[model samples]
Target: MEQQEVKTPEAVAMLDMLKAVPQQGKFMFGHHDDPVYGIGWDGDSARSDVKSVCGDYPAVMSFDLGRIEIYGDKNLDNVSTDRIRQEVVAQYERGGMVSFSWHADNPLTGKDSWDVSDSTVVKSILPGGANHDKFMGWLDKIADYLNSIQTADGTKVPVLFRPWHEHTGSWFWWGQNLCSTEDYKALWKMTYDRMQEKGATQLIYAYSPGTEPKDSTEYLERYPGDEIVDLIGVDAYQYDKDTFGQNLENALTIMTQVSKAHGKAMAVTETGYETIPDSVWWTGTLLPAIEKYPISYVLVWRNARERENHYYAPYPGQVSAADFVRFYEHPKTVFAEDMKQFEKKK
Candidate 1:
């Protein structure tokens, strides 16, 4: 396959690892904010809900850059950038992969990411728009952060950078209903170019839309281009057991087809049932839904420390803990300890 051309050796190797994962008949399991916090603890680097439930940490550790665009000391979740940097490096050192998602604040409305009050937000951040320069500054902050992720020897750690995600939904300012197709494409390209110009080379870009694309056509409706995206992913959550399995299967089929045609990797960028109400959700629902697909990884959302009913992955004594152990022990599921081979490539 003709892979996307990345600038750095680390990024090239990381992309290769993503490409080779499914060929080996395995898909990595991931968790958002796994090392930073968990269901009952905060700021503990040694703690991970997935690890507590199973025996190893997730293969992919996802972080957010929501407040990074504004030069905030902490992310929107109040996790400090210093902590994120530390944990990101720690995860990489542990032979695990790191992925970042950005929920950038609305530049036009000066509100949160969910502020889709203005329809011209995407247009205003393009090259010639009024907020163009300001947006460029925001990208600079992002670039700086990305560039700062380094090992003890100062070697940059390769990371999967996912920005402007879930654009298929109408919740964020950059959503489909708020921006034209051309403008959205331009936004992705501009971010890519800026990262390159600023020397943030150890990045593999992922383009992920919200779930339920009818087919490959709809999945790629707002695709920036194969040149800018190293991975094709989708964010699908389980609202109910009845429809989630078939829905996920259908989405993965579309993702597989699109990824093969475009020579990009594919993943379930975000997924999980809130609170894991079902005891066998891991193996019975999620595992079965994705087992047949050639996906690189499946990342569930965070296990929030504050909200009682807002967690995704299981904790130590959660109802799904036993079943999660089964999922972890499954040969098809890959975790941090199982990533040594891929880490060798880096």
Candidate 2:
């Protein structure tokens, strides 16, 4: 299938790099970290640990913008917006790929991302609804932060801006049952349109569903379109040995097929075994499931210092630390040290 042409030069360059991932025989690894504020591994410390353990930092870094539109201070797991922005710019300067996911609060309920009290929240925020203007106001804050991210030389840092992720899951207010497919599509379109209008052109949209769909039809049911979405992915996690590897494998297989059909890059936007109870979960479970597909990247959850059992990646003393190190050393896994070979979008 012919790849969809990207409008922005930066996006085009990024797409090219992503498309080349499989050819390089490596997939970039990412981790979500509130590292800057010391909630996760300390600022620069996560990377330092990755380097010490695996001889390099992760090739990609992820952050959440869940609370920036609401509190402006407190956030998902108490991560500060100030620290997030700083960390984003720092990662960009270091030539690392950065991705952001929005666990946006439900506009109508004034509750968290998990709130499902208002099933029509997306409808309310669409065109001529009651909360449309208020939602746009929130988007304004998001666009402002996105536009303000830049490198030391004033280059706009490109980000894989993934919003409304895991829409197939029922845990979030924007989940499948909470909003109609049309409303979900409208939500994504409005986000892209608003951000572009606000000069946040460094953004590349990604569409991620929760689990593996039965086929492409199910996968693309709520997809905005190929033109608006640059990446296709899923958010699948492993909780036990029963469905761990099979679930991930099935999700990636679906993602690969769907991405090929639309000519978009595929990614494991979110996947990890929390606490990594299995000593060999890294190479044995995660790697085998992903290596079969041509994915651009795979991002583990995070290592929160506050929550002793909430982390996905291994620390120095964790049981899976040795296996994770082996996973990092694998020929198919790309870490921060390997990113120098890839072209960074300007």
Candidate 3:
């Protein structure tokens, strides 16, 4: 074989080390100062919103149930699919992260038994049923859509597919009282295997188990392997930040330790001061640790305050937006301060 050149010893070493290791996860987006604010607009066409607002920033964007559904009434129309694919490839060229997730209200494949909460009025539903044939068919369709948008590196862009997330709670039909433990495991494993066979290896499956004591063991109980898990994370949302703080701290600490134990990196896959005013929490408590923790990313779960939601975008007070933006994006901020000093050391 011909000799290959090395740009830098560090670069060469990093590449060689990463070669055997499946690049598990990295900071998909930067710190708050380097914020990634992509919202769930009408559908895939909401690329306009991203392009208009934070286009310059390397943000992580995503599609919702409206854009990805296949059979249900929410299925992506032919026009949306064609348009979104074009937009997605453009995003790839622009070095933006493309992601899509689902929380189906009814994951039925025509079999009633497979539908766990058939009679109950669960707020969230899985997009798939546990029946082998119906599920495989659904997975094939889903994987095909994802494969259509490969990265510039020729691999499908790694997706932050967070289905069946927050299962410790009962709001979603897949949670506590909905399905048996075995069925849940079977559902998870089958989904993983089905997606892999279809060549959508670019997916970064995030098992975002709820931040309750019971779900802690259940989270790792079915972790397929490093091959399947891209990032280990938690979806914790409640009023008491003081109470949630200890839980959040312990969760991240334990997750980081456990992930490191398995040689995987950690992330606060979904988090934010949802109802709490951004002022008290964003700067007072959250910012102090912005540079302190080993967290890879902190995605502000933006449930835009449109439909009587207090968790609206632009954050709380008018001043809060400025403070929020400055804290995350401003110079001399923790994130920026840390980076500036760290780079000088390098």
Candidate 4:
């Protein structure tokens, strides 16, 4: 791997580990909300469920920093600020990794992340725009929170910070069709620069676009640059029960090629078949889609227990429980217990 400038020793070690993943013949399995929320579970219940099924927890744990911009209370998705920091530190201590996604609400439209009502949201957040200062304030709050995440030994908990993700889709205001390429690039650069100015150096930035690209050109059409991006990935979901598998394969292939050309790590940042109605979806569909690529990690979306048909991982009695165990036991998949390999590299 070529020498690259990064913020922390953890970040440097993480890049080295990711670059060496192909030779390792394993990809870390990540679960969103595994530590914060779960299906018919939370906290230890979720971890216990994973342990009962696979005899280990997920190697990477995820949390969302959505409401931090608006509320300033660290209450995004029902997770408190203090608990989120504690969870990240705890995972780090246990030889696991942490990643965070942001679904920041539109500061101008006052709408959710999906709102593309005003295409100017991205432009407005750039330097000298209407909402530029307000957006900077939001970044400051995020920086303060990130700076506070430290382990018992006071080492910064390195985070895979994924912001402005899935931007290839037309849903978010920063989407390709909604904002100009230059405007979107400016948005990403400004956010990164502001966060750096506010002392959030422990973040490893990831650029993830929505899935199903025709070729590498489409995947890198809106790329900010290789300098500001540490990882490249795709956020694809299995919507069509039968055809989504092929789309996932195509997307991963394109992302893998592009990431390698840029000398960056790639990942399946977000993916899942909700409800997991197919008994063998884990080993049958999800595993096959990612196994061919030298990606760093594959993270499924959260399993919202309160909502029916909103989960990705199999729980105690779910139909796919047996197949999920098979997926976990696969030689190419790495769970929590297996993460010691990376920590040892550090």
Best by lDDT: 1
User: Clashes in each model (backbone N, CA, C under 3 Å)?
Assistant: 0, 0, 5, 0
Which residue segments of model 2 deviate by more than 4 Å? 1-8, 37-49, 344-346
Q: In model 3, which regions exceed 4 Å deviation?
A: 1-58, 65-67, 71-79, 82-87, 109-131, 151-155, 214-219, 289-291, 303-306, 310-312, 315-319, 330-346
Q: What order do candidates take by lDDT, descending?
A: 1, 4, 2, 3
lDDT of 1 by residue, 198-237 (tens): 8888999999997757889888888989878999898999
Worst 10 residues of 2 by lDDT: 34-43
**Evaluation by TM-score, superior candidate among 2 and 4:** 4
Per-prediction TM-score to the true structure, in the order listed:
0.97, 0.93, 0.68, 0.95
lDDT of 4: 0.83
Question: lDDT per prediction?
Answer: 0.90, 0.81, 0.49, 0.83
Ranking by TM-score: 1, 4, 2, 3
Q: Per-residue lDDT for 1-346 in model 3, tens only?
A: 6443212232222222222221322233322211222233333333332123223332444554332544432333223555455555665444444445555534443332224545332322224424445445557777787777654566454455656676666566566577656556666776777776776665666666667744336557645466556567676654665766666776776676667677654656666665446555655655553334455555545434233443422433333555455445533232211322222122
Cα lDDT tens digits, model 2, 1-346, are 6543334566566677778877787799988863442224555534544555566667788888887888877467676776777778877666678899998988898889999887888899999999999999999999888777776777677889999999887789889899999889998889988887787878888899988477778888999998799998889899787787787777877887887778889999998888889999988888888898999999988877676677777777778889988888788988877777886534
lDDT of 3: 0.49
Error of 3 at 111 (Å): 13
